[model samples]
Target: MATTKEYRLGEFTFPRGWFMIATADDINSYKPRQIRFFAHDFVLYRGRESGKPVLLDAYCCHMGNPLGAKNTTSYVVRDNGGTNIEGDCIRCPYHAWRFGPDGKCNQIPYSKDPIPESARIKAWRVVESMGAIWIWYDPEGGAPEWDAPALAEWDDPAWVTPKWDNVGMLAQHPQEVVDNISDYAHLGPIHGSTVDRYENEFRGHLAIQRQCGGHRTLVAADGTRSILHTITTYHGPGVLISDLTGLYDAKLLIMHTPVEDGSIQIWHSLVVKSPSGAAKAGITDAVTAAQFQETSLLSFAQDFEAWTVKAPCINGMFVPSDGPFMKQRTWYKQFYNPRAKERDYLDRCEGVYVPKGVVPYSEATVA
Candidate 1:
């Protein structure tokens, strides 16, 4: 039975939002990378011509076979739509239908006239910045356009940052990943006490703060003391940056790219404040080398194990000490609630969950 539900990662029925897809390396290497953003089931291909980056669609709508997964074909097709640096078109493997980078079916082997304009598949709105590619997933098309989060240091030459990048599966909703950032209880156990007793509270505003680089941290208070998280998000929907105060002398930035529904491709940028002379001598080179060697492997393995094993959708579970989770629940409700402004009056209803400051259920009900 195919349910209208999109994800099978966990108990979660994922609502529409932008998700992280891939890291910079995944698409920038010699071989092009193909990624799928699950919320809308959109696929992207990072094609290049003369060393220039081009991101386009991968699947053919006519037959559903992947467009350019092999080397036998030109790997790019020309649609009647338009051609870019990578060429005007490519040939499909299954039926040999031609497609342009714009995802139009240029020609059918037997048909004389070109494919219709309505037959073309869609391409994502990709923004490349801070060494990563971000895609927008706007289901209702109501998603507002915003600038990428400001990261001043990316262009600075003086700073040397270590990086760990990888793609992995998370048996959870996108919201679960974001909620983990503010969930303090798990930090002590899962992250090995990296975060201490953090107090989270609702500030009831789009709380934004400047970080070390051009990254700005945003927090919206829900209800829990531990759920108040500092999230570094860009103007678009998909990119997420987290400044880890515990890793690499306490200055590391994590960028999460949505590849699809069940997983994410990550870029871990470990920015150090400064290093000693001996460490600084070859430290940048050393750290970059280690990133490809040890750090990336270790971090990916650990996170993969942690998130996959836990209840993927963690909101329903009641843990008295999980203040952060509680807070995030409130945030989630507020974020999706259409009547958020009038939610206070609605709290008077029976059995409807409300945050602490809202009228308590005990007071509203007769004992």
Candidate 2:
């Protein structure tokens, strides 16, 4: 009989950080998209003329009509997409209440008086990286410091990045995806194309070092497996890079955030190291770009079908292939354990589910 290792359910709290919602590609497609998460709605649009990405609440402050009307209003105005903007202001559809990107009510279509500050809906800080957009959930007035973990050849002219593909799995709890990443046994059966040959034998202490950019690198070293995997993660509370085998060979940058309690928004990217004489074979930039876009999408789709039908919460059952899941649970505790003293907080706090929308402050303070 196989020996059972020490594994506990609810053993860790999912890190409370800025979760990535959409990629830069999603907004560039000329669609005014609204992603609802944590019980709030954020609308994404391309900035006028400047072409910077802007994120704000969907409702216009004036009469609460959606600021960017899909398939109709064009979500653009003044060289940008959206409704009318008198000055640096957005107008409402119902009453034309002009508002700025900061969510400040700037004009009243009918009223001559200036709007009170209380009427304004504040805008969240938006950050762009790896061709994606991120927003913070900082309730303390202080935004989470921007942390952009270093990526291999991210800005290199020689490497071209493919447009990202958004994915979703019909299940509650973001932990499921985390579990999927840690569960290596399933790679062969679920994502066998590129992952079938990799082996997961290492079992090492996980140490997370916060870098200069406000992001983190979680290093796991298991001597037995003879493998070292460094997960280059970001402050959007998302994973920015996965340096598993080596620097540029077979790397992945995963941007995942919550859509709701059970649903998730996932965007996956890849950076492949070129091989000798591979260029002459016509493995050109365009070809590699298309491959990353297509393969990553297919991989997530497979996980979607698998996780959606598996279970609502995975902690209820145990599987033999859960060795990696067991290790990942240990790593998640670094986020919420106040005192940062405990190796496992899920054991101390029972019946606790850090579902999205629940205020992170209300939970136990982090050390």
Candidate 3:
């Protein structure tokens, strides 16, 4: 695995954007769950009082105790009936220092000393959406430039909301994962896609790919294969949502969050429109959606297989026919840099591009 410095991605080891830290199910019990992301440990839980998701730097300011780590011995946990969580606040198992959702110690037992302003941990801004919890992580610690992710069809009854597939951890930099957006050549070999048209575009934080072709995988429930058209876009640095058309009209999500400098955890899910074209999805639609999700996971696994052991492409021997690798990389750099330099990077990369000898997904072109 290669470090962010190895790729010269800019100042931040992790990029600036919204990233998934845990699935909504991970906190359904309302228990504090320990999570690691962006190379730091954090405590994630649903606030009992506010009923909202909260993320805080895992360790306490006093004695450096982990507020989220499970402990059965501490009276705090024992008295709280197996949890140190008190409403929206968590009491440190070591010292019983209660921290509010804002991460400030609001209560300190025994000692009468003023609650020092320094007695606190960093609180992360988080949002619960689409069965996932997301944090707006910025190395510069700026407010979110964009809202957390959501799918319109997620609430629509006509779509079957499939459970998220646990793709597990990958020991590779996210840059390589983002490279797949413009990976035209890989379609045929990796996915067995007989590509008829392909193109890519980079605009601001969006790296998009538009392609359509016949595919060997991702067949219909009846085992039918047809031309697949997908318009895939990276919402920021970590979230990927693809609108797919072919065997079924579905919204596919492949999201990854940096676990550290050179590793990430990934998840995949498919929200498929009801096959029966019913106004509301039923058990049969869910079964079909789950099956299609598995097929989608299989298709994604092909790329995961290559990413498992491939050397980091610090500098690729890229070619025109290989898609716009450099431009895609340029677009990725914006997140690794200060917000001020975002426009500079976008100026260099924003535009539509079609690989050499391939027909554009759309007839329009930019200079």
Candidate 4:
């Protein structure tokens, strides 16, 4: 797999940002989920006591026993009716040494010997929102510089909350996906968009793309099409949220988190405003929202298909007609480099851009 060094991303193999670890529904007290990302293994579970998410290194320090992996034959597990999870803590199946949610060993089960302070696992901080859990991953071990991905619409009663579509992992590096931010030309060729106007902007942590056009896949089945406008922003390097106004007023969330150096996990979901415009979304609104999400998923699948098989774009023959790919690439470097150098990278890329012959989004209309 091509690594971050190969792409010259930065000194760190993984960029620092808030990455989706799992959905709220994924973790349970019955079985901890073993998750792999950033080239490390982690155990994620819902603390049975607080009902909050807890993340720890998969290894139990007392011994080499894998904490979250299933062990059906062990008495340590079977005695607990199939799990070693003890309230907010998890007991090592091998030695029965229980570790608290803070990743400290609180009990030795059989020994009166003092539990060394080092007899613990590595715990991670996680925040839950938008029906998902996110970890603020930083190689520098700094607190989150910004808020996790969220939208007020997720809390609005009139918007139907849709389930996340796990689009699976992409073998390609994230640079391939992040490039889509300023990709003005592909919008026409790949998605069959007849763009009337387009523009991209870079400001601080946000990479914004605004466009209005007629979309092919998002239209009605009987060959009816309407003007679609999307104001999309990369909240950071990982989360892409597009507020769309077209057939339905909706917000499209396309989230990707690095799993390995050259691979990333992508998820697609959409929150559609009540089709009936009712103040509170009804059962019928939910059904309509599901259908709309299916259509939106189809749109994202178009991009997913190409990224699945493409080689890395280490060097490209960029032109003025193309979107500001180079600028966006520089913007992405901020997350990979030290936070102190963030300004240096941003100074070079932060600005509004329009392709050579395109009308700016602020000036475009369907007519």
Q: So what's the TM-score on candidate 3?
A: 0.97
In lDDT terms, how accurate is model 3?
A: 0.90
Q: By lDDT, highest first, what's the ranking?
A: 3, 4, 2, 1
TM-scores, all candidates, are 0.61, 0.66, 0.97, 0.96
Query: Which scores greater on lDDT, model 1 or model 2?
Result: 2
What's the residue-level lDDT of 253 in candidate 1? Answer: 50
Native-to-model Cα distance after best TM-score fit, residue 150 in candidate 2, in Å: 6.2
C-alpha RMSD values across all candidates: 10.0, 11.2, 2.5, 1.6
lDDT of 1 at 230: 31
Better of 1 and 4 by lDDT: 4
Clashing pairs in 4: none
Query: What is candidate 4's CA lDDT for residue 282?
Result: 99
lDDT pick, better of 2 and 3: 3
lDDT of each: 0.43, 0.50, 0.90, 0.89
Tell me the tens digit of each residue's lDDT in model 3 across 41-85: 999988887889989999999999888888889998888878888
| Clashes within 3 Å, all models in order | 25, 15, 0, 0
Give the per-residue lDDT digits (tens) of candidate 1, residues 88-148. Answer: 3455556667666566767787787756777676655656555656555444444533454
